[model samples]
Target: MKNLLYFFLLTFTVVHAQDKPNILWITIEDTSPQFIGCYGNKDASTPVIDKLAEQGIRFTNAFSTGTVCSPSRSTIITGVPTFKMGTGNHRSNYPIPDFIHGFPDYLQQQGYYTSNNVKTDYNIANEKDFIKEAWNESSRTASWRGRSKEQPFFSVFNFAESHQSRTMSMSFDWYVKNVWNYLPEDDKIADDAFEMPPFYNDTPEMRKQFARVYNSIKLTDNRIGELLEKLDKDGLRDNTIIFFYADHGEGMPRGKTNGINLGYRVPFIVWFPEKYKHLSPWGEAGSVTDELISFEDLAPTMISLAGGKVPDYLNGRILIGENRSQPKDYLLLSSDRADNGPDLVRTITDGRFVYSRNFMPFMPEMRYIRYIEIADITKHMRSDFKLKKLNTLQEKIFKTRPHEVLYDVENDIWETNNLVYNSEYNAILKKMRNQLDTKVLQARDILFAPEYEIGLISKNQTPYLYRLDDAKYPFQDIYNVASLSGLKSKKTAKEQIKLLKSKNEIVRYWAAVGLMSQNKTTLESFKNKLMVALHDKYPPVAITVAAIVHENFKTEESTQLLKQYCKSDNMDLALMTINYLLYVDDKAPFIETIKKVHDMPNRNYNVKAGCMDFLGILNIVENTSKTEN
Candidate 1:
């Protein structure tokens, strides 16, 4: 009787597993909804993706929590925002709690076979083990085909044809040979056929390069069609649900790493087979929903679909199925350091208006990030800037940005206008600012601390857990000081000057940054305070104050301070110091110091990159180490 009872239990488990729907995710890299045909772009040739939208529900408002790939992928896998995880900086690989497994682990526990083929750039320490635990099979050929008979599956296929490399960074000849060469003649996009965005110069060189965006996407669409065809042939089409979306925004120069809507918005569609049609919260086939969904919502939503309990630690709401939570009123997005470029921006969007607070307002939107600076598009734009061929609007990319910017993406699709100071949008601006502040503090955002500090903290505890200790992080105080950055007023400067004496080093660091954001005239009155802060115990505070003094007063004392810190053994501090040297009035005095740091063995990538940038600006090419590691 006991043996017979065990057999019955095994039968029930198999049947229950077979009843669950198989989920297939088709993720393309670096694409925005504006570039897709389903999103009303006449120039796009994404017929397969548009057809998928017609067969399912199209999400009109979908965003990536982060603008870049690795950090965005980290959020998707964990259902945690980058700011909270301390993974906002690209490729930082900061340690997270060992118990914090990817959401797919929950699906695996529920007897679903998971596979990823095969992009696993999750941007957290111990990523190899994390990926290993999440997927039954994760390789170039990983798929549902490897799962047991009658078992449900969650399979992800990442397409790279529309990635940044194919779109802009790679040589045009390589694009033609690789992406365009495989396209059918009729599907090929013509250079003249595409309309150029107003922000870019309309010269032949620009048009020829921009046209790659269209053709590369067309190739991506073709691949999606082939995959759909294979799914039908495999006889799983009847029970499989298909999700099609991109990792982040477009891979173009101003789109991928930016904090605006163009950088975070993605093309998202979910197709439910007849077996799982009842599970979709959005209506039937061909429906479009404007519900605000971000990458953070994906993990819990997927776990909910797989019949697993959503953990409380996952902040994202269950976006679909019976457990679907209420839609978000606003989404908080972040953009941080991407490849040796230091910046911090927090953005909020209500599916129509987008607001961004540029904490590092001194750097232009198109700052000299080493990875992008080497791209052909960036080089071309730089040449155009030097020739003064670009219009005022086009040249704005290289200029310092406003402290705050608001855009009505519904009306201004290109985001050419700033509505932050406009009287009519004052209420909206205030609402967004308040919402951003509340959300950041609620999450106890750890990215506000310098990466150097995060590294030190991570040595003792994971940043995810470290942030929860209010006494250690003192986030409210730090946030209060950080929020003062870019508010151009003597009153704000006075407040920052007073806070420079805060006992907390992080708070003092932010206070110094606030003073740095002020105009030279306003800083003149606070010169004494700034000078004293240049010797503050915290290296970041001293480095920031040094930048202010070097830029305005050109004091020899401040110059020497910056030079000394540039060679500090602490790479993060060294990176901070070298970055400040890039903007100062006198680059000559720092040349030798930068060169010495540049030639230092085993230097941090950001520090070495900054040194190279400083030397490059002076047109001084020096012998440097070849490898970043």
Candidate 2:
């Protein structure tokens, strides 16, 4: 009788699990909404994705937390923003708290089998273990088919057909074989089929390269169609909630790594089957919602759908189900260092307008990021620039950006015009600016702490927790000093110079950045103060001051200091010093110093890449590093 009772209990448990809804996430890489038919792009040929939007809920305003792949995926996996986790930089591998694992761990606790079809670039220090704990199976062949009979499963199939390489980076011949050839003749996009974005020059060479965007997305759509067919073939279509979306924005030159809407916005759709239609917060079939959603919201929403408890550490809102939170007023987006490029930019978008603060105004939107710089399209643009073929607007990518920029993205899809200086929109800009400040302070954003300092603190404690300690972070003090970075005026210069005497090294570091951002005339007046700061105890501060003195005053002393740190044992410091040297007009003095660092054994790849870029620009040698974008 006891054996019979145990058998009955096990049967009941399995039956209960079968009643739960299955969740399927169909994710594509490096795509933007502007290139999709559902988003009103006439030139797009994405029939499968458009069908999902037609039969499901199409989100009009969705965004990624970060611009690049790993950082953005890091936020999607953990229900927290990269800024708060100290994982804002691309592929930084910073450690978070032990209690914080992937959100799928919650679903598993709720008796659901979880599978990820082999793309776990979570960007955490303990990635392998994290994946093992989060999913029942995570491999190319892993699937929900492996689950027990009648047990509900949550599976993610990530398609990389639309990644940056196929879209732009790889050679055209490779693209033809991999992407274009896969599409039907009718689906294949002609070179002149689509209108190019105004940002790029409208030459035939440019158009030929731009066609990859359309063809690659079409091939990705074909893959999506195949997966949907399998779901129906298995007779699980009615029981599964299908989610179709891209990892971030388009993989185009400026779209992938930039902080603007073109980089952060993504295509998001949720198709609720008849059985799970009640879970839709917005209506049932073929509904369109203008609600603001971000990558940070994915974890909590998925956990909520699985009928699991959402951890307090997960700050994202539950987007669907009975626990659906109210819509957000605005979304905060961030972009940090990617590959050999070092930048810090934060943006706030309220669905219609985008306001950006370029903390590192010294770097251009199209700076010498080795990953993008080596691309054929980038080479084409650079060639046009050298030949004086590009207009002023096209040339803007190569120049330093302003401290702040505002755009009515609704009206200006290309985001070419700046509204920050417009008197008519001053009130709107001020409100958005204040919102960003409040959000950053409340989150205790760890990215405000330099990457080198984050490394130092992570040795003793995780940067995620270290940011919360007011005594250790002093975020307000650091933020105030950093905010004065790009303001070039008498008052601002005087204030930054005074902050150079602060006890905090980070504060002094920003002060040096502020002084460096000033014009040559302003820097000349403060030469004495800068000369003292050039020998700052903090290597980062010294490096910034060195760049200023060497560039403006043409002093060898400052260049010598920069060159010494180029070979510093600290790779972060070495990378920092090398980036500044890349901007200097004369590369003769630092040639040997750069080559030595590049030849150093076991040097950081990014540092070596930076040195390699410098040498390549001077016709010394081509960069041969096999580092992935």
Candidate 3:
């Protein structure tokens, strides 16, 4: 019996050794395949990526489940669609400690030491479960060698170089300043050569803005080269299976952090020295397959390769080796919240066609601020509403979208042409719509249900109630309210006043947010309630109220409220006070607030930048007025 058991154990070990592969996933931020040479970009000089393609396989039609960082990463890590995980929106604050079972945890169970090099944007229940070793705080190169060699490992190295808001440190300013240097001068800076994507007008300034974006990409590619060189030098290249992909598309108008195909469709390349000879079912080295795959497939693929059992909760399928399945008939993508507002958009795409469902069809496709940031011409164009020579890209960015949209991707690579109304494509649209309906039903999407119950249940009362079924508004429920819906509603005003007096901190904060959106009498009532809320044990509520008052009101009362809160021990609240002061053009007061909070512990850099930016905007506005005078 002992001999028979030993033989069986040996056999099992041999099989497991053959099945497991060391996984090294390199996820880059804000990139698309269209810019890479392997994906047919003639201008991009991504030699490292092209070399990887020469060794492994390149996916022609890889898609991200969502466009934004959190949702896309969540979908990839959880191996589930964003809608299924109840995390389709960015504002759905991930409740920690649940451990929603990621691929890394599965691999750990299989005895692989899993580690991530920064970038844990997974809307996971508990971040600790996903990243057992907090290697993200350190450099990627150092993190790679931090692991033990005894255990075959799964390492994720995320490069942030491609991220938008390109830094001056990287010499990326050249791309923005010298757009004509890269492209031909004859290439009409304002003409059809620069295809103005739908929702954008055809303007010269918009064209110039796109040139800056292209420059940022160039800088990102340089960083990729550095990382790849480091991997080769560490002698990890031979055994490691390196897979490169982007979190989402470039943060440009219509694309970037939104849920358009331009936003979600990204570059994907895999390179494994041992497995390089064995072609993926799609093709051999440097071959690009037009298979429809989403980020959701990533987790399952990694799990399967690591010889780990794929979880039942995952909707993703493994797409490697003998088990490689054909691409799905359609891929689903969704976006809910990013920055300050809610944008609920759903997209279904086959290889040839794309169908979109804009839940908030009335809202303009592009945010005004984002548009101005990307295209300088947009800033000029906005000043003259009657200007008829609006660029196509500008038009696409500013225009209101229809409820449903259909595009022939085969012909319209830029997605400028909408074919939803064309009779010829009615059947195709109907088929895709039916597919979405069936999938949503199968997934048991809660959005389809008539009632969505929110709020808490306590020992005494049944808890608070907010019936979303009747609310009709899709995205507004998630924000601070003051940012979108101005202070105007009487009912919400009354509710805010009542809630500000609540014993619970959570309820009080939400109420304060509501109050920030009400009229004068309600505002006064809100202020009184805030005085009581400020004294409450909860620091966040006090800080939030102080910020709201400073942002909305410019009176002496608002200034006093801010001054009081700026003295709080909570650095976050103090920062908020400073930010609010900055927003209301009270620069002197803002500087004083900042000076007080300068030494406060745990002050967020982004908050500080927001304050600075606001100050800069004030100066710019002031200077422009002076020049005009």
Candidate 4:
């Protein structure tokens, strides 16, 4: 018995030793490389990140698959391209493949206790089972300590301070009052020195916007430093392999959570004190590697470092030690939906050259009002185009793009100059086009197929627009939807209704969506129209109608209709019905319904969570009501 115990102990020790490097992935929300001192941003003071870069490796040319949080994070965790993961668009509703496991999940399988700091917006079918524990920043440290000591740990900490709506009014004012005074007279003050991107005009308001952004980044840096200090206090610093990165690009005019290079390109730094000296296959400490890397590579790299086998389904390569090869021959970046501009654009980049394929080429540059509103410089430029205060070179970059574009990054760093028209670049452009075509085909992009479908169904016998050619005004309906959302007066209701009759299903859907926000009188005519839409072939339209009805009306007829639909053979419609029922009366029945659905063995966790969350919300509401009563 003693000898057998010794042998088992020896085996456990060997396995434990192999997995000593605990991964601590620190992700910042909506941040860009420009804020980090390690990335050569002298204006920003990011000592914590700078120290980490010095200890390990800082990747200079890392790009995210998508510019937004959901798609980028989904690609990172799945070790697959956004398109392959069915998360090519924002807020994806499709089920996540079982084979696609998050790095933390993989680590847990290897006996590591994995935890996350509250944010898990991977846009997966179900998000509950992804992490072992999730807590707000305040409780994250305590939660980490509460984990079992026998197992090594993997923890992801996300800092949300830098997120848009940078609510640091006091900090912003301080920076303006103090930091601005320290700079030399020639040094560009935020009010004078700030230059807008190609899409915007140079204006003082734009400069102030830049200043506010800088202050937000500073606050993020401070929080990151605090988290690092906690790791040290807990004596986990030496053993932890810290990886720091932003979810996507900075949220600004052209960069605001879009698929553009400025939006997707991010900073990536990895530091492991235990293996610091030995893991320099790429280069020395603080050495910036120009090798193009993407978020997809992160999961495989983490898994490989944890002494685990890389699953064959993962498309990314491990980027540590001997595996430091040149980046993918051509990296693909894509965007689908955000705000009011439902545009689709894809780009192929080979470090030196970038080729963009715009599916919606006719969409105006400033299709979304939010983009224009926040873009102080663009607003100014559009207000007075006659002034020509904006440079012509910048104007060309801001103007509507063509179906195809080629940029030599070596010469045009800002991607301002298009070399596609040049005869000399024709061969390069052709090669890139072929590569993109082949990649899309290989990836099984739905759009590339002969019978490409837009995943919409409507019974109104409307003309369904299908085409191989790129359409420019695909986002006009989206813009109209925005107008409806912002409408305050009854006078605009008729105009809003007119916009809802657009040929695009997305437009009509948004119009119906906008009606839900109005008063009873405004929605009276629209409600009957919406009820008629419940029979619309499109599941989303039906689901939206059901939701609106359930929220506004608690009639027995409506409840019966919802309950009947909830039992439908079509799981999509059924799910939508259950969601609507949750918004209506009788908490007990709704909770029971959710529990019954959740108890099913084969139902997806997301489906379960969708039901369970309603119960959770009811519990909260009940507690609040009890206190008040």
Number of the top-ranking candidate, with lDDT as the measure: 1
Q: Rank the candidates by lDDT, best first.
A: 1, 2, 4, 3
Winning candidate number (TM-score): 2
Model 3 per-residue lDDT tens digits across residues 134-177? 23223344355655444466778777655654411123354445
Candidate 2 C-alpha lDDT tens digits along 407-507: 89889988999998899998999999999998878888888777889889878888889988888778899999998888989889999999999998888
Clashing pairs in 2: none
Candidate 3 vs candidate 4: which has greater lDDT?
A: 4
Residue 548 lDDT in candidate 2: 87
For candidate 3, the lDDT comes to: 0.59
Error (Å) of candidate 3 at residue 453 is: 6.5
In model 2, the runs with Cα more than 4 Å from the true position are 1-13, 620-629
Q: What are the TM-scores, per candidate, against the unseen true structure?
A: 0.95, 0.96, 0.66, 0.65
Q: Per-residue error at 364 for model 4, in Å?
A: 3.2
- C-alpha lDDT values of all predictions: 0.88, 0.88, 0.59, 0.60
Error of 2 at 101 (Å): 1.3
For 1-629, candidate 4 gives per-residue lDDT tens digits of 99999778756854674446766888887777766678766666566778888877888777888877777777876777766545655665545555566766666556566667757777665665653322212234433564555556777888876665452223345544644443345433344433344555556655666665665566677678888888889988777777888888776555645555667778888776755446556666666677888887888877777667778877677787555444567787777655323456677888678787765443434433233344444444444443445677645544455657787755665567778789998899999988876666555443221101232211221111221122522443354353354343466655656655566655555555555455566666666665666565544455556656656654444455565555555554565455445434455545565677667766643345455545554654565566556
